[model samples]
Target: MDKIIKTSKTIRAILKVLFWVVAVVSVVILAAILVALFMKGGTALDGGFSITLGNYSLLLNQEYSSQQLTSLHFMTFANVALFGTLSCYIIRVLLNVFEPMSQGKPFSTTISVALKKLAYAILIMGIINLVLQIATNLIFYNVFDIPSLFNADRVESCSISIVSDGSFIIWFFILRLVGHIFKYGETLQQLSDETL
Candidate 1:
């Protein structure tokens, strides 16, 4: 048990560090996109725009039917950054819950409360991700003329994806159920401790 606890603590500490790095990087990237947009001002949407970071790149060169799409590429990056940061934060909260569990107190109120908070965060992020997925599909397929990875039809465009819409809702309910289970466990553990 001591070895397990030590290992758990070590892994959790590493994960916490990684999460902070990821969160910071996400925020920095988002800030960079915003700064670039502001620097360009009105001309930001007038012509082609592209930003490359390492191996990845965002390009908007095709003629768009609506002027609104001129900023869609930037919005896409911003959305990605927001999602990444939020995910890191969620994981960080989860790590907090684990810290107590790793110390041999698995059914405490702190764990239950953190689990509940994590569940709600997952649900909220799920809804936001669903909306973003639809927008992304539309933007990438229609505006950018990028083909779908799942679909073989190259020209056919679709805004909705079953995986994105279905999976998040399913996970939200699952996590909420787990959180309630943990709360029940915490109550039982408290009762046991009191009787002892």
Candidate 2:
């Protein structure tokens, strides 16, 4: 129990730092996009810019119109920003669950509630991501005339894919089950406390 509490505290501290880092990085990306938009004539982003951030590297050597480049940047930025925001929220939910565990209350109602919140957040984000992916794919294929990466040969007739990979749905069910298990643990903990 002492070890668990210590680990929980450590994880909570790390999550706090991660939340702030994600928030700051997202804000910086957004600010950069806005600045580029305002300084379109003077910015290299409109012409050829090598974007090497983290694992993503895009070298825009081909000539593209300013509007096309800006649109691409905005879409890319929106995707990154959305992912960062969701990651921060998930971290926050994890922190909430860990707080009680850090205080030696592993089976507290707070943990159950936090688990449920996390489950719901996962479900909501999954649906939103699915929608965005479909929309983005359609736009890239139809508007930009880009070949579909997923359906390489079927680019001539882009069809809407409703088939889910089932990863998110599986996660939602698993988290909900875990939340229920925690709720049962909380009940047992309450009963034990009363008996004592």
Candidate 3:
């Protein structure tokens, strides 16, 4: 019993460290991405990479007027049902495995600690996507409402060009998909339990 407790304690400690590390890294990376985006989008972002800080207003520029940004955003949202289904459908289902981890003795000792790690990740991504959605919408509705916000002076979510990059699109899809997969796992576990 003592050994099991110690092992669980160690795993919990490791998980705590890993969780904070992931959270910190996520924040830092997000900040850097915002900074980079600002630099690339506006006058405030014009310095060297190390000192680079550009205009936040440029986000309103529809940066890909010449590219496919508009279509990409449309595709992402238009297929949100598909995206949601494909991305988060079963990710949460597997969470039941850990549900017992909280109470000590679980239905399946076979559940790997890795599942905990993965569930942690999916939760984060789901939250981040929700936050990003809200933030972008606020920027569109409020931030861009200011007359001087943009160089060319535009106000629309479609006017924003963050979606212009294909790589960014791919990255988002990957994150969303992983989150969904994890959610599906959690959900399936729940549904099975309900039937049983």
Question: Each prediction's TM-score against the native?
Answer: 0.68, 0.78, 0.29
Selected candidate, larger TM-score, 2 vs 3: 2
Maximum-TM-score candidate: 2
Which stretches of candidate 1 lie above 4 Å from their native place? 39-70, 140-165
Q: In model 3, what is the error at residue 184, expressed in angstroms?
A: 21
RMSD of each: 6.5, 5.3, 13.6
Error of 2 at 114 (Å): 0.5
- Residue 76 displacement (Å), model 2: 2.3
Clashes of each: 0, 0, 29
Best by lDDT: 2
CA shift at 99, candidate 1, in angstroms?
Answer: 1.7
Q: Which structure is stronger by TM-score: 1 or 3? A: 1
* Candidate 1: Cα lDDT at 196: 100
Model 3 TM-score (2 dp): 0.29
How well does candidate 3 score on lDDT at residue 57? 26
lDDT for each residue of candidate 2 in 46-131, tens digit (9 for 90 to 100): 43645443597656454445455565566666777788889889999999999999999999888889988898889988887887
Q: Per the 3 Å backbone cut-off, how many clashing residue pairs does candidate 2 have? A: 0
